[model samples]
Target: MSAANSPDFPMFVSVAEARQMLAALLPALETEWVGVGQGYGRTLAQPLAALVSHPSATESALDGIACRAADTLGASASAPAHLQLTGESRAGVPFAGEVGPGQCIRIYTGAPMPAGADAIAPVEQLIDDGPDAVLVQRPASPADVRPEGGDFRAGEEVMPAGLRLTAPRLALAAALGHARLPVRRRLRVALLSTGDEVIEPGQPLLPGQVYDSNRIGLSAMLEECGCEVLPLGHAADSPGALQAAIDSIGGADLLLTSGGVSMGKYDFMRDLLIVQGRVSFWKVRMRPGGPALLGGWNGLPVFGLPGNPVSSLVVFHVIVRPALTGQPVQTLRLRAGTAFRGLPDKVAFWRANIVGGEVHDYGKQGSGVLRSLSEAGALVVVPEGGSVAAGDEVDVVLL
Candidate 1:
């Protein structure tokens, strides 16, 4: 008999236990090289090192004049030092001549420092007495100029492998002269929904029928995690139908099926997994989507999510999404906008939004209500048997 169907295994495991069990089984996706411009949201597979030193030469940081620090010494607002303006240095246009004693070079932002100049004085700090000469009232510090390799040196490791490329990170790669970056290939996840009552959207609805909302919702969630979704559509709640649906997804790295995992008479996923595959865990002791199943089928990892739209998304954010992105979801603590009371046995994920740093839950916390997930920007996690009174601190997971 399979472990899921055996009497020894718990019918429901804690969320932590379920995640820990699956983490050991899920394999890492392969890597590929992609254009750096298109790498946002993708995880890097190789460490990126600097190709050339930034600010290859010492340059000016201000749009003013470059001169010897000694030239401006001992000058004050009342007694100013005057220096002859020899030449000017515009950005990308270097002055061919060097500065000599009692001379300064007019320079703009990012302009290379002249051969003899070691400091820059801002235009506001000096009086421009025509183009021939300038007056500086105070001494310029050597720190006024950016030194060579001020940002990074050649061959220095700037970005490490496994980092999810964000806008700023991509810019860093571009600045390092990498036209392409090595990134992990997107995970392929198959999506399927089970239940006779579930009908396709735009189809005529019968008395007991509802649109297949999970397919679209789950697809979006999987896509957001950079997974290539192989949507297998819907299947009836039956042994044969479930098997056929599973067979349709040929090469998915992960299979995600919504509904049919609970103990209802029509819920066939839990029982079928026990008979045809190896179920890592049958249920998770969490609210809004507690009837979750994780398993392996024909060597492919499978996630059986609850049928309710909101529940599926919550569980995805807490579990599946993190596994795909290879990053832990972000969480914060904020003041509760209202009191929350729940059962002592199950942890609750309350749909919520942060307004002025306060956590406010949605009007309806039901699993089937997609509106709750739509209007919420975060999930307020209420620990088992925990009560959060108004104005109390509660932990939140950002969506």
Candidate 2:
């Protein structure tokens, strides 16, 4: 369907359609080698394989005496085994002598097993008689040993590409001897806030002037998605100012603007985008953010959100962020008691707080109130023309 006449135009692109558009428009960028410690939260650009064999050689897994399993099998708890302690082996140190029958070596955790050693009797299971000798209280078996390459063999694939490098994953890479990893380069995004009434925060409020919360909020959200946020500041309601702001942000991977995309007389963002870019869609069938714009400006994805505070955030989380991250969009069904009566035909996203397993709608559902959104844990999505009763389930998009 065409962008203008399509049933689900601009705002409410179907989940599949949105994902396909994102994939067709954006391609994975170049990769860079970063240290494993700095890889957390970044997606891997290439598969991370072991640089060398983990452990590099056979090693001990515990502090105890290392000996051949056959040497200790005959002895039992009733009649303890006796073996001469040849030498001590510590972590990162290798035993110099081979362990033969009736011979054992005192080994600590992580120490490499000596040649001919097949099992380890934990220190707790043995009694120390003197510095050179230790007595085993019970017979050890082959199961008591950690053989070579038991954890990981050489040239084994550890972590594959496209994986988000979390803390535990980074640690595993480090343990696998990966000092550096390949990660995707960060996407650069340009942000613009539109409207004559909006003023920068901390500035004295003149008549008809409101603080420019959208710019600040949208910038933080872009950065949270791992983008390099370039704040282009506020654009006046005039088309000249909007066009100037659009031209100034050159070579950005994505352009995000708030306000002036709706059907209002002062709305100029859609016109500006049509002139400089392709306007894919102008409006969506959704509440709180129905007047949204999606297009490509100068070969960069551009998203135009509503001027209201809550509406801007809702669209940002629902559409913009997921498009940038290439993450699949998921619709969650709200727990019982989240439905509202008299919901309209358009999909409505309202701020709600989850307490005691129930979602209570926050007061002041107006898009202008940022405080309501700040206190909300989720966005309760009411489908078109659907009315919900107490304890009825509804779809929710978690913020």
Number of the predicted model whose lDDT against the real structure is largest = 1
lDDT value, candidate 2, whole model: 0.77
Give me the runs in candidate 2 sitting further than 4 Å from their true place.
1-12, 32-41, 63-84, 100-104, 116-127, 135-151, 174-180, 206-209, 274-277, 330-366, 369-399
| Residue-wise C-alpha lDDT for candidate 1, range 209-276, written one tens digit per residue | 88998898889888778788998988998989999989877878889999988778778887788778
The stretch of ten residues in a row with the least summed lDDT in candidate 1 is: 1-10
Candidate with best TM-score:
1
Instruction: Quote each prediction's TM-score.
Output: 0.88, 0.77
TM accuracy, model 1: 0.88
Candidate 2 structure quality by residue, lDDT tens digits, 340-386: 65445576777788878777787678877889878888887766777
